[model samples]
Target chain A: MPGDAWSRWRAFAFFAVLLVAIAVLFAGASALYRVPPAAVVHDVHLRVEGPGWTIEYRADTTPNSTAYAILAEAADRLGFVLDARRYVAPLDSVLVESINGTRNGEDGLWWLYWVDGAYGDVGADRKALHDGSDVLWAFREYPPREASP
Target chain B: MNVRSFSLRPHKRGKVPPWKLALLLIAAGVLGRLVLWEMPNVEPVMAVALIAGMLLGGYYVILVPVAVMVGTDVLTYALGWSGAYSPVQILGLGAFVYSGFVLAAAIGQAYRPRLLFRTRTIAVMARISIPATILFDLWTAFGDWLAISRHPPMNWSLGQVLEMQVPFTLVHLASSLIFVPIFGTLFLYLHTHGWPMAGPSPSGTDDSGPE
Candidate 1:
């Protein structure tokens, strides 16, 4: 009975140690790898290229504003609808489904974004912008052999 | 403490038929996965797989989880759900994903003797779920890196992929911690009670009940 008790306690202790170690590792990695929040960016340029139409705007954005945030702001000012949906799996971020009534999968085209000439690797809500950032939302077919955003 | 104690043979005949129990588990696993499809890295399949190993034992351990994953995967692709992969990506990614569940089942099989329906056993199950989840996440993350993340457009380095994986892994850990014990207790109860009377054992009859 004593040996049994000892083994159980040992198991519990080992579990506790593992938990603590994981916590420490998570904290360390997060600190080391997490993208630091961007400072407030004045004159963040945003462009939306919809089917046969284009809209451009500039705005001073708060700190940590993502590409989606800027697009939503421009849409509000310009009076065009910015339709988006949040997807949680694969990653937690918003997908821009449509802009100004141009829905995704229409004519085999989807709304994709590029920031500073780089294709957005993450969802628009996760593609954080910095000072003088150039954000572009284009409704177009995916590039050859390219995965959908 | 003996080798025989860990042996998976001699599975007793419960009132419930092994096939029915297997179906119930597969359905639960598949449904849970579909319902939580949007919430990446959070699902009950792993927990159910582990429980399937413990309750059903033998080949059902592998059969149950495989059925759940393959069934849901087909549905996801057919329905055009998010994270639907191309045929090539499916083969590459599925190897890791399916194996993760199989590994969880293997863990459950190993821990079958300790599942005594006691408080200590519950704690033990909960504790083991952590590593099971971590292993699953790590393996699948590597798979993602190999099949998807390393490709063009993103072309993320392995370190970058791992860095991004931390949050998903944390959520997975949370999911496993919550589901493993709940399912473990539920199925253990069902096994003991032998619900849905009158069905054949998966293996040939062994009349001697669980040790």
Candidate 2:
């Protein structure tokens, strides 16, 4: 056991590095399940604002890191006009900023991702919805799904 | 053969300067950054984590940029990222890498941290992180300017490069703010839990001398 300490440190270092690398991989992999094109949204509430056309959805799923992307994505299906430049979104309407989804009361904080508002999860990325409901795309500082006793 | 002076290794003593270990850590972090360069959009948080690890591990500063080149170069080949990187690109990457490390090292060396966390006497621990991260932002911005505008001629005009990188710079700053203290806390936590790599460096560190 002369090198016992080295062996232990090696194990610790290897695992520590492995964890970071794996986390990165998972970040990449998780995007695979994104709504075809890819984005984060484990859950969320969607609300569309307009005069006559209103699409509201309480999508009990995760939300992506970029709120504008969600807005754009939702707009794509709902036929709403997206002015990205005004809101600093690209043509894809992707949010340039990284949002901490954890503030939504869940631990879905993507240190790097897209969103205008935060989400409790990224499962909201694929939430299918009905017509005329206001897609609120709500990403608050508290989780929407948690039960308070 | 002479009877005296039986030193065969690099160092004449039994233990190496702890600073060397720290230098190695920072070098490793730089390498990590390089690896992340071609991934379309490298996560700022990951970059922050890598730099923070280097700092907390007490790694050397120069290692950051050097390792970044090697790491990213290897990853590029492995990942088959299209578009060959010219000498200008390489130089640009190196300059940016240096900007990151110089700031991290300056802050680290100045603060020879023994423990993280705030007691009454340990207020400097938290304060140093802010400056360290801000300095990183400033250096990186300058590096971009120098690399594209003057040094090696780049395809991007001075204004173009500045505008293009403005967003990323903000992201970098934000991530740094989030990262520096986080890694500091992690380093402290690991040290408290008996992680061997968590120990102070073997270097003299010379907290008193000029950097």
Candidate 3:
């Protein structure tokens, strides 16, 4: 008894439908997502300097990109460690702990990021980028006497 | 002594002559597990075990996944991957993970009477696979937490452990959802075509299915 051999083809057909459903679901998800466009090249001066070493590079940052994104791109090309983490609320961006083997809290020394000669209030991961902006990351003491914009 | 015996005994029941098919399926399952070992939460062991249970019997539902895992784990160890776990931890994880396969097999046995390549069967398989996958992941994650929490570096609460593991289990769920239907249907079709079905003998005179 073939037991209705025609019924068995239902498996393949069912799998086909399943695959199509999955494809459609994924396609729908991707359509709903806001995919960022390709970055437009804007020459931004990036300087990551410490007491012992200074690494300078020029990067093409996209409009409204984060400083951390630019630094991450630079770090990958430059072969340096950019150890950062984003904690829970009130700290939802990358907090730089170390760069290029230089760590924060070594005798109270820390990595402070300055963009366009102004102290960035937000974390590096949140700082908006602009064309021709000079980004500086320095390992220095905090609580400077003069207010840095 | 009304020792009501089943015609489909492991040693008996040479009706369809399924040894070759069974061996091939077991070997294929082991090979699949080995080749796909690197993929997290994605493997055919559960689906294979379910098929084994549904077709072979409840006895094999327990045996198939264990055999697949142990066989592949041994080969994996020989190839220097060994899962990097201690013997005790391996044993513990295997027990929990195997339980999921057992549950799947049990479901197969329970549903064997009407297990066919139809819409209802597919829906049941999907439902069963989700819980089976969750059970396997939870059991394995418990094993992981047990192994990790003992180490000095880990001071995580159980809630935190589960929280951290939500993504992995979710992936496992998706994997099960995908693989269960694919393999289950394939095996079901094969079993229908006389590919050695084994399982607990259907009561009241072996209504298991066609030979």
Best by TM-score: 1
Q: Report each candidate's C-alpha RMSD, comma-separated, in the order given.
A: 5.9, 17.0, 11.8
Flag the better candidate by lDDT, 1 or 2.
1
Which regions of candidate 1 are displaced past 4 Å?
A1-39, A49-55, A60-64, A87-92, A105-110, A139-149, B1-15, B196-211
lDDT of 2 by residue, B1-211 (tens): 0111212112111123434433444454555455544332233323333333333333333444345445555676566442323456556756675556555554444443443222211223434544565566556656656653333213335565455454444444334434444444444343333345556654222212221
- Candidate that would win on lDDT: 1
lDDT of 1 by residue, B68-137 (tens): 9999988987786644244677788899999989888777766554444454555666667778888888
| TM-score of every candidate relative to the true structure | 0.75, 0.39, 0.54
- Candidate 1: which pairs clash? none
What is the descending DockQ order? 1, 3, 2
Better of 2 and 3 by DockQ: 3
Model 3 stretches with alpha carbons more than 4 Å out: A1-17, A20-149, B1-18, B117-119, B195-206, B209-211
lDDT of 3 by residue, A43-122 (tens): 78889887788999887645435677778877888888888755332113466777888877666567777778876645
What DockQ results do all the predictions give, each relative to the true complex? 0.23, 0.02, 0.06
lDDT scores for all predictions? 0.72, 0.40, 0.62
